[model samples]
Target: MGIVGYFLPMLICAAIPVQSLSRNAETALCQTQEMQGLCALSGKWRNQLQSEITITCKKGTIQGLYDSTVGNGAYDLVGKYLQVNETDYIVGWSVAYKNQHRDARSTASWTGVFYAAEDIIKTQWIRAAFKNPEDYWSTFTTNQDTFSRVQSHPCLHNNRN
Candidate 1:
């Protein structure tokens, strides 16, 4: 006779369908092969250098800007997004900017995959400094970087270091 007793049964029955619809809709819009789900990557990301990147995705193309806290300033980035194995979110992009901190001209390119579970992008990048062509050995350097999504509002359990 209580409302809780009556509504519990109805709520339980409704839960399955609501969950199914949500799952189905996510699959339809988030498929990587169709480039529909790149929107998931749209947001602000912070790199280890404290550099910030704001990215937007449409179709298979990515348009974004990289703001270097340590470098010159802000630079436009061009890149492509792909869905591999229909489950993995893959991305590659390049940016050319002057590194005022290093007093050098350089172009850096990154190839990485977005980890949805962790909301992070791990990348390996090769930065080439423009200098004497013969100084090729010292011109290029490689390193791995992790970019974490910058939350607009911190989570209750946000423990990012």
Candidate 2:
């Protein structure tokens, strides 16, 4: 099977919401020690694609805004740390994409996951263009990106060209 065919099912499955865990179970899974390091991943990360992603953790959820060669957008991510075997994953939906006009531009619903480690987030995203509802599933393109945390510089905040 081709790449799209191979990942289509997985993408569909990822979209399905999993059952919520109980308070005690959640506490056991998302330990304070494990989650502590996740805070360090909240800062700015520069990806191989030269995109800058700024992530913030709030109430067990991650909010991210990214500026890249393609475009600028924001996503709301939610996930958990499975302390049993030491693995963390975050899934997010692209909430909005801003165009050159600084207006809200509607794009494909981006659904992806970030596999997290010490200071890195391995991202695999499938962008499906849905201009035609009937053929949306066949229009997906995948991107595998790696992002590493970097110390922020004052000049980086300036958007001047």
Candidate 3:
């Protein structure tokens, strides 16, 4: 057999494990276990301000949120602000994919927020901005198209029982 016939399948199989390991590492890194007590908004929340958010936090849970509107709902613990008109907390999270291969385009970022009592998770795409480099808020872009690059990005968990 020629090189193509002998190594083609082998090369494909070898790619699988490497991909799986990379995804596993990402999931583990994103889990809230590492954050522990840092997740202050462990309760649900409602928005009272004119802003476009209705967030709810799962009790003792720290899950990420993704919103399509409002800078793709990009937020940072120290930079983003949430105003609650009702009882509870505002929970927000983000996901990003960095491409190691020069051939593939990198995704901007995915951000989301949860409205506790409503049990709603909104997801949106955002591109990184450089207006106010020092402030986290300035780095947010409300563009949903940025998600295409990371749509194939794997999730840490499987809902399949």
Candidate 4:
């Protein structure tokens, strides 16, 4: 076989494996626990304080609005999936606080582990710092927060007829 004929077949065979590998990678990402967690967390969540957070996840990033009686804010969070045996992600968020006694902003770094079975994003704020020096006392060295999925149609009463 001439050089052209031999190289053509070799390139075709190489391209086939590359395409298969690409598909496999996509499949793996689709089924990854991290992705599943992102999907599950894309909805609304509520904390014990009766505060509500509406989160939207897109391309490994999260944006949310936190509404509470004390303060309301918007946050932009970025996350990276970790290669732990379980589904783990590290995320950081910058919150712009509004309508509060003190107009201030804060940034927090969190380590989150997604519990697929419970459909909850268990997060720990590893570090938090405020933009204003006066708010330094409020800085959180370590704090644990759980974001539970908010049930849709919470006001609807389920009555069996």
Off by over 4 Å in 4: 1-38, 73-92, 99-102, 126-141, 151-161
Q: Which regions of candidate 1 fall more than 4 Å away from where they truly are?
A: 1-38, 85-87, 98-104, 151-161
Candidate order by lDDT, decreasing, is: 1, 4, 2, 3
lDDT of 4 at 147: 70
Q: Write the per-residue lDDT of candidate 3 for residues 4-60, one digit (tens) a residue.
A: 553333223222332554755644533533322222232222222222221212233
What digit string (tens of lDDT, one per residue) describes model 1 on residues 106-157? Answer: 8888999988778899999999988787887798889988999884111111
lDDT of 2 by residue, 1-161 (tens): 78455334322222222234455543443343323323333446677878766554433444445666566443333333222233444544353455554543344333344444565666666654545778666666677777776642111122111
For each predicted model, how many residue pairs clash, with residues at least 3 apart or on different chains? 0, 0, 17, 0
Where in model 2 is the C-alpha error above 4 Å? 1-38, 72-95, 99-118, 133-138, 152-161
Query: How well does candidate 2 match the true structure, expressed as C-alpha RMSD?
Result: 14.7
Measured against the true structure, the TM-scores of the candidates, in listed sequence, are: 0.64, 0.49, 0.25, 0.49
Most accurate candidate by TM-score: 1
lDDT of 2: 0.46
Candidate with top lDDT is 1
Worst-scoring 10-residue span by lDDT in model 3: 146-155
The whole-model lDDT of each prediction reads: 0.63, 0.46, 0.33, 0.48
lDDT of 4 by residue, 1-161 (tens): 67455334222222232234355554453353333333334446676666665554434555555555455443333344442335444444444453445454545455677565676667776545554678767676687777777742111111100
Model 2 residue 77 distance off true place after TM-score fit, in angstroms: 7.5
